[model samples]
Target: MKQVVQNYKSGELAVLDVPVPGCKPGGVLVRTAYSLISTGTELMKVSEAGMSMLGKARSRPDQVAKVMQSVATNGMSATYRKVINQLDSYTPLGYSLCGVVEQVGPGIDDVAVGDLVACAGNEHALHAELNWVPKNLYARVPDGLAPQHAAFGTVGSIALQGVRRGEPQLGEVALVIGLGLIGQLVVQLLVASGARVIGVDPDPARCELAERLGAEACGDPASAAVENSVAEITGGLGVDQVYLAAGGGSNQPVELAARLSRDRGRVVDIGKCRLDLPWNAYYEKELDVRFSRSYGPGRYDPEYELEGRDYPIGYVRWTERRNLACFLDLLARDNVDVEPLVSHVADFGDAVKTYQRLKDGELKAVAVLFRYPEAVEEGEAEAPSVAVPAVRRGTSVPAPARSGRAPVRLAFVGAGNYATSMLLPHLAQRDGVELSTVVTTTALSATNAQRKFGFARATTDLDAVLGDPSVDAVFVVTRHSSHAELTRKALLAGKTVFVEKPLALTEEELAGVLAAVEESGNDRLQVGFNRRFAPLLQEARKQFGARTGPASLRYLVNAGRLQHGSWYLQQSTEGTRFAGEGGHFVDTASWLLDADPTSVYAVATPGNEDLQVVLDYPDGSTATLSYVTSGPSGFPKETLDLVADGRALRLDDFVRASVYGRKRWVSSRLPKARDKGQSAELAAFVKAVRTGGPMPVPLESLVATTAATLAVRTSLVSGAPVTLARGR
Candidate 1:
C-alpha cells in the first residue's frame, strides 16, 4: 500500500510503498476511498520542516525548551541522537478519511466488512491505500452521503467541538475571525445553531464566500464594514461570542477578540493563533476565555481511541467518535454543507506534488481531498442515460370512496426545515390527512419529525415506507439530488408522489422519472410548484380578464443570500441555484399566460450571482424573469406584473394586487401574513387523492414547466435561445 510520508529534517514528501497495516484486534482494516488535507495545520508543519535547524528551533521555542531539559537529564550525546533520529525518519500524514471496511477484528461489533466508515486519528486514518482504525475512532457513514464528503468528518468534528465550546445560543450574534476551512465550518455550525455570524479575513474572495454561505456580513479584518455590521446586528452591543480561528505570529486575533466581545462574553480559541492577550481590554470586558480541544473529549486518550473503551453517555455527551457521527449526520440531513468548501480533488498518486504546490502557495484552496484509485475508477463510469418516455396523461390508481375512508396516509421521505415548516405544518392537523411514516437518513431526524408532527412511526428504512400498502402518498421532500430517484421509486410502488420543485437536476434524471411512469403506467405525481396556486395572484388574473394580443409578463424574484451552510449552495452535487428554484417562476408564468413556453433564453451575471430568463409562449406572449441575490433583505421576495390591451395588473409580493382597465379593481391588504399557497395546494392535492380526479395541476403542464425550467440552464450555457420540443 502507498502512503504519504514526510521527512522533517530533509523537507521531502513522498508517496512511499509501505506495508499495509494489519487488522489488529478491537479495530477494523479499511480500504481508503478519500482522504482530506488539513490546509492550516498540515501546511504549517510542512513549512516548518523546510526550515533550517535553527529556524525550526526559533519556530518552536517550547520544543527547544524540552530539548534543553532532555540534554541535562540524559547528557548531550544521547539527547542529540534521539532528536536527529526523530526528525530524519518518515512520518505519516492525514488524520481524516473515508473508506470501506475490508476486515473487522474481534471485539468490534458495530461495523462489519464492506461497510463504509469515516475514520479519525493520525496514526489510524493515514493517507494510505489501507488503514487499521480502532472502533472508537471510526463512524459508519450515513446512507446516501458521498464518501468524499464523509472524509470531512474529522475536521468537521473539530469545528463542531469548537462551536460547542463557545456555547452559542439562538439568535445570538457571533464574530468569526477567520475564513479558512475550519473557520468556514464554524461559521456554518453557528448559523445552524440559530446565531447570526460576521466573518473577518484578509482575503476578499474568502470573505465573499463566507457571506454567500450565510454570514450576515464579511470583510477584511481591518475594514470598517465588519465593525459596522457587528454594531448594526447587535444594536450597538458587542457580539455574544468571538471565535479565533486564525493562525499567525501577530497578536491581532486575541486583541480583536477582546475588543469585539461583549462584557462577560465567551472567547474560544480553536486554532493555533498568537495568544499574547492584551490585559487591559480583556480586563475591562472581563471576558471568559476558553480553549477547545480537537474533536472534543477522548481525543488524545489512548484508552478511549486505541483500546475501544467507550465513555458513559450520561457523563460525557459528546466524545470524539460521537462528534464524528454528529457531523456526519449533519451532512446527511443537509444541515452543514461541505461541498462548497471543497476547492480541489487530486489523485492519491499526486500527493507529493499537491503538497508541494500548497506549501509553495501555488494552489489556493480552503480544502482539498485525495481520491484513491478505486474511487477514481468508479467515478470514470458514465452516468446512465434514458430516453424520456411519452407522457401518459390522467393515468392513476383508482381512489377509494371519499366517505369514511381511512385518512389519506402520507409518508414523508425527508424531515428538513422546509418540510417541517411549509408542508408538514399544513397537513399535521388537517382533518382528512394522516401523517403515517417519516423516513430520514438519520434516526434522530426521523424521531424528531415523528415527535413534532404526530407521525404514526419513524424509521430510516425507506423501503418499508414504500412497500407499505397503507401509505397512500409519499412526499419526496429531500434534497434536490435525491428527488428524482425517490419519486421514481414511490411511483413504481403505486403511491402518489408530491415532490418539491426542480424535479430533476439533469435531463437524464428527468428522463428516468418519466421512464418509471411509462414502466408503471402511473402518472400520479405532483411537483411542488406552489406559486401558481397563490390566491392573490389567481384573483388578480381573473380580474384582468382576457387579452387579445401578446401580453408581456414580468416576474422579479429577489432571491436573497442563503445561510452559510445551506444545502442549496452545493451546486456540484445538488445542481445550480437557478436549476433548483427557477421552476417556480416558470410554472407561475405559464399558469398566467395559459400556455407552455415555446422557447427559452437566459443569461447570468459574471459570477452567475444573478439571472434573467425570457420565455416565449405559443401566442407570441412573453415572460421575463429576473432572479437576483444582490437585492436587499428588507425588500419583498416575489413580485409580478402583467400588461396588455391598455390594461395592467400588478401583484405586490403576494401581499396585495391591483388591476387597471375600464373598471379598476384592487384586493384588500392581507392582515397577518402573505400566503404562497402551501395550504391551498395541500388541500387540492388531498381532494384529488380522495376523489380519484386528475391532479390539481395537469400532468402535461407540470412536465412542460419542468422542461422549460431546465432549458434556462441550457440557454445559459449555450448563449442562445433553446427551443422547447413539444411532445415526444
Candidate 2:
C-alpha cells in the first residue's frame, strides 16, 4: 500500500509504496477511506525536519541530551551512526482516519470485518491506504455519519478531551484560546454543553469561522478586544474556564489564558507552546492549572492500546476510544459540525505536495483531508502505488560483485537501527562475507541499506532472500515476536541463521526454534550474546577460567526509563524491557560463568523503577542483576563485579576492567573504538559459516539462556523462584 512519509534528514515528503502491514493480535486492519492531516502537529514536524542540525538541536533539547548520553555510553562513532540512522529514516504522518475494517486480528472482539470505523493513534492511523489499528484506538462510526466527517473523530476527541479538562457546566462562560481546527470544535462542544464560549486567535478568518460555529464571541489574543470580549460575554466577569488550544512557540497563549480566567477558575492547556506563566497572575487569582494529554485516559498505556485492555465506564468515562465514539455520536446528532473546518481535500497520491503547500503557507487550510479511492470489485482501494527510485541513505561504494570465490553470502531481513548501526558496519568490513540482499518493510530503508552497505539488491520481499540458494546466511534483527518464525524459515531453507537476543518470546516459540535448529543439523543458529566476545570480557575470562570455586557476579544496569508509549513498552512488539533487554545480561552471565543457570528469581518496584533478578547456577554460583531506570544519567549504564577464589574483578561499562587479587592488573580503553564484541561476534559467525566449524556459541547454551530469561518474567509474576528445566 502507498503511504505518505517524510524524510527527516532532507525534509523531503514522498508517497511511497510500502508493504501492507500484517494485522497483529488485538488490532483490526482497516482500508482507509479518509485521513485528516493535523496542521499543528504535522507542520511542526515538517518545520523541524527542514532545519539544520544545529537548528534541530536547538528545537529539541531533550533529544540533544539523549545524543550526549549516547556519546557518553557508546562513544562518538557509535552514537554518530545511531543519530544519522534516525535522521535518514522515514517518519509516517497523520493520526486520524475513517476506514472500512478489512480484517480483524486474533483476540479482538469489539469490531468485525466490514465495519466502518474511525481509527486513532499516531502510530496506528497513519496516512496510508491500509492501517492496522489496535482495538482501543478505533471505534465504529455512528450510523449515517459520513466517513469524511468521521475522519475528524480523533481531532474531535482532542477537542472534547480539552473541554472535559475545562469542566464547563451549564450557564458557565468559557474561553477557548486559539480558534484553529480544534478550537472551532471546542467551541461547538462547549456551546452544545450550554456554555457560552469566546474564541481567541490572531487570525481574523478563524475568529469569524468560530463565531459562525456558535461561539458567543471571538477576538484576537493580541488585541485589547480579547479581554473586552471575554468580559462582555461573561457580564464583566472573566470566563469561568480558559481552554488553551493554540499551537505555537509563544508564551502569550498561557498568559492570555491566565488573564482571561476568573478568580479560582481553571485553565487547561491542550496545545504545544511555551509555558512560562507569570507567577503573580495565578498566585493572586488562586487559579487551577492543568494540561490535557492527547485524546484521553488510555492515550499512552500500552496495555490499554496494544493488549485490548479497557477501563470500566464507571471508573473512566471517556477513554481515547470512547472520546472518538462520542465525537462520532455528536457529529451524527448534528451537535457538532466539522464540514466547514476542512479547508482542503487532496487525493491520497497528492498528500506529499499538500503537506509542502501547507508548510510553505501556500495553502490557507485549517483541516486538510486526504481521500482514498473507494474499493473496487476486489475490495482494495484504487490508489495507485507510487514508484520511488532506489537510493541509499548512507554512503555508496562502487565495489565489485561476488567473484568465483563466492564468499559466504548473507541476507539481512530487518535493516533497523541495530542492523544499520552495529551489525552492518562490521559485516561491511569482513573479508570472506558478502552483503547479498537487504529486505526491509519500506522502500526507502531497503534502498538505503542496499546502497550504503553494498547489498546486491534491495527488495521488500523476504521470500526472495529465503528462496535464493546462493545466500548462505540470514540475520533476523526484526521485532522479537518474529524471531522464531524468521529463524525457523531461514534454517529450513538451509541457511545459517543469527537472531538477536531473547531468541523467542514464549516457550512455545522457543520449542519451535529448537526444533528447527535440530532439523538444520545443530550448527546453524547463533543468538546475539555479543558481550561474551567483548575484548574486556575475554581477558577477564582468561583470568577466571581456572577458578575452582563458584563465582559471584553482580551486574548493574542503569536502563533509564522509557517513555510511556515507547515501542519498548509495547508488550506485543518488544514485550517489555525485561524480555527485550534483560536477556543480554542473562546470556552474558551464563557465558562468563560457563555454567547454565538452574533457577531464576526477579522482583521490581512499582512505576518503572528498580528491578532485581537473581540467577542460580548448578555449581552454586549466583549472578545478581540490578536494573534500575531511576538512577542518575551520569552513571555508567552497565557495571560488572565478580568475586571468586579469593579474588575480585570489576568491569566498568565494558570499557575497562580491573582485577583486585594477586594477579593485579587492568585492561583499559582501545586506541580507536570500544570493542563491545559486536565485531568479534559477527566475524566468528561468518568464519563458522565459511569453515564448517562449530557455531560461536552452542545451541544448547542459546536455548538455556533464552529459557532463563523467559523464566525471569515468570518469576516476577509468580512471585517465586522459577527453576529452569534445561539439562546441563
Per-model clash counts, in order, read 4, 2
Which tens-of-lDDT digit does each residue in 422-448 have in candidate 1?
999999999988999999999999999
Candidate 2 ranges with C-alpha deviation above 4 Å: 375-728
- Model 2, span 103-204: residue lDDT tens: 999987878888999999899999999999988999999877767789999999999999999888999998888888888899999989999888888887
Predicted candidate 2: what Cα RMSD to the true structure?
24.6
How accurate locally, in lDDT, is each candidate? 0.87, 0.82
Model 1, CA-based lDDT: 0.87
Best by lDDT: 1
* Residue-level error in angstroms, candidate 2, position 4: 0.6
